[model samples]
Every structure is written in structure tokens, then in C-alpha cells.
Target: GESVGLHLPTLSVQEGDNSIINCAYSNSASDYFIWYKQESGKGPQFIIDIRSNMDKRQGQRVTVLLNKTVKHLSLQIAATQPGDSAVYFCAENIAGRGGADGLTFGKGTHLIIQP
Candidate 1:
């Protein structure tokens, strides 16, 4: 289920700088987590993901880290660019709950890029 917040938390970063987004989940039974990037007027796009069995995974310009003990997840974007400005969301999937379509999302965090 999509969890919406009254106000979206925000992070500001300079263009070309690295940006780190953090998220925390409460379900210990969740075995998979994914980070998504959603530009205005569009749905979330896949950024990176990490499984419970793995602590970290890297994509083109993104990295996802998982801390099972804390039920925390984070996404690191290297060399942030203007196009990176968007709302980022973290979703958790409980084991056997479903596949990608069954993810439960957190209130998105808005990433603001400063030129």
C-alpha cells in the first residue's frame, strides 16, 4: 500500500555532489526492499534494490544498502545531477507476500538539486 505523508521530507544537494537517501522499515519479516525515483507527474521508477540475504548492491550510479538488524535501507547516488531531482521512495516486501507489485511504500522524500 502507498503510504502518503502530509508533508514530504526533503534533501538538498548540489549538482555533481553525491546524495544519500535513507529509509527505515518496521517489518522484520520483510525479505526484500527497493528504492524508487519518481519525477513529478510520474510513478516511481526502479533505482536499486537489496535482498535480506545481501547487505549491499550497486547499479549504474546508485547503491543500495540494507541493515537487517535495524530494518533500515539507504540509496546513494554518485555525482548527483539536475535530473536526479525527484521524490524517492523506499518499499518493503514481506516474504511471500507477493512480487514487485505487492510492495508497500513509504512516504517519499523529495530530493532538491541546487545548481
Candidate 2:
């Protein structure tokens, strides 16, 4: 089984700082990945995504780096702020067309904002 739980329950950071969250997936065959941000009770919002072929992808204030060699993944947030405080999730999907429902998500890292 994969590590569904986050190692850190909460991370506190000052405004205008940068934050990094980590996650590990279980399936070796999973080729698709997505990162989502959930603010409290809201649903997860798509942040960015990368395929197995790619090692790195980026978006506004956010970046996702994948390491197929170790099955490890990380998310980097630049210029973290109070609005950026939210629970982040990493999800993996099996590479293929049949697996449309392919989404196994890790627990989540809660980003706390300190004013």
C-alpha cells in the first residue's frame, strides 16, 4: 500500500515565504500525476500535473517535480502567503485510457499561514 498519510500534519510559515510539500505514491505503473489544493471544506482544485515521461512541470507560484526512479514526488510553492494556506493533495493515476477513474490520493499537508 502507498503512504496515504502525510508526514507533517501542519506547516506554519510567515507571509511571503515559500513552502514545499511532499508525497509518496504506491503504484509503480501509475504514469499520470496531479496536485490539488483544498481550502478547508472546499473540493480539491487542480494545481498542476505531469506525466511519467516528464520529470518536472510548473504553474503560477507552484511547481511539481516527479522522480520515477524513486517513486517520490514533491510540490514547491513560491512566495507563500495567508491566501496560499490550504491543504495540498497529491494524486496518482494509472497510465492508460481505461482508467478514467484513476485517482488515488494521499492524505494531505495542511499549510498554515502566520501573519
Candidate 3:
């Protein structure tokens, strides 16, 4: 069963430092994972994604790590800036199931940047 309703986690980091956000999922059958960043009063934006076959994937300044063994996922942001401050979410997509239903999202994590 999925989570009914839950609050997002919170993470605080200093400017220019690296930020790491973690998430845990309950579905072991899921094979696709994505990370999104959402700013205030805005929609969530795509950051990075990884498939179950891959343990890690990297983008420009963002990296996503997937550990199916423990049903864990994480996002790493390098050289964090004030602009990077936002709420991050991890979503899981069950292979061949969510064709039209879409992905299931985690609560999310608030990333705050300190000057």
C-alpha cells in the first residue's frame, strides 16, 4: 500500500556546499525513479532520473543514486547555491504499469540554503 498523506522532509545546507537528499520507497517492483526540484509557488522541475538497472546517473550538476536492495534513493547537488533552494521529490514508476496512470511521488524534501 502507498502512503496516505505525509509531510515532506527538510534539509538545510550552506551556500557553496553540496546537498544530499534521501528518500525511501515501499514498492520493490518499481523499476524507474526520478528526482524533481520545485521552487516556491511553482511546479516541480525535472532534475535527474535512473533506471533499476543502473545504480547511478549524473547530470550537469545533479546526480541520482538508486539502491533497489534497500529500496532507497538519493539525489546529490553539487556546489549548492541560493537558487538551488527548493523542495525536492523522488518519484517511482512501476515498469509497464503506469502507462497512463503515471508515476507515484514521495512526500518530498525541503532544501534550504543558508548564506
Which one is best on lDDT?
1
Put the candidates in lDDT order, highest first.
1, 2, 3
For residue 112, what is the lDDT in candidate 3? 96
Q: What digit string (tens of lDDT, one per residue) describes model 3 on residues 13-93?
A: 999999889888887778888888899999979888888999999999888888889788889999999999998988888
Clashing pairs in model 2, backbone N/Cα/C closer than 3 A? none
TM-score of each: 0.90, 0.90, 0.89
* Pairs that clash in candidate 1: none
Report the C-alpha lDDT of model 1 over 16-58, residue by residue, as the tens digit: 9998888888777888888889999998898877789899999
Clashing pairs counted in every model: 0, 0, 0
Evaluated at residue 45, the lDDT of candidate 2 is 90
Q: Give candidate 3's error at residue 93 in angstroms.
A: 0.9
lDDT of all the models against the reference? Answer: 0.84, 0.83, 0.83
User: After TM-score superposition, what is the CA distance of residue 76 in candidate 1 from its true location, in Å?
Assistant: 0.3
Tell how far residue 96 is off in model 2, in angstroms: 1.0
For model 3, name the residue pairs that clash.
none
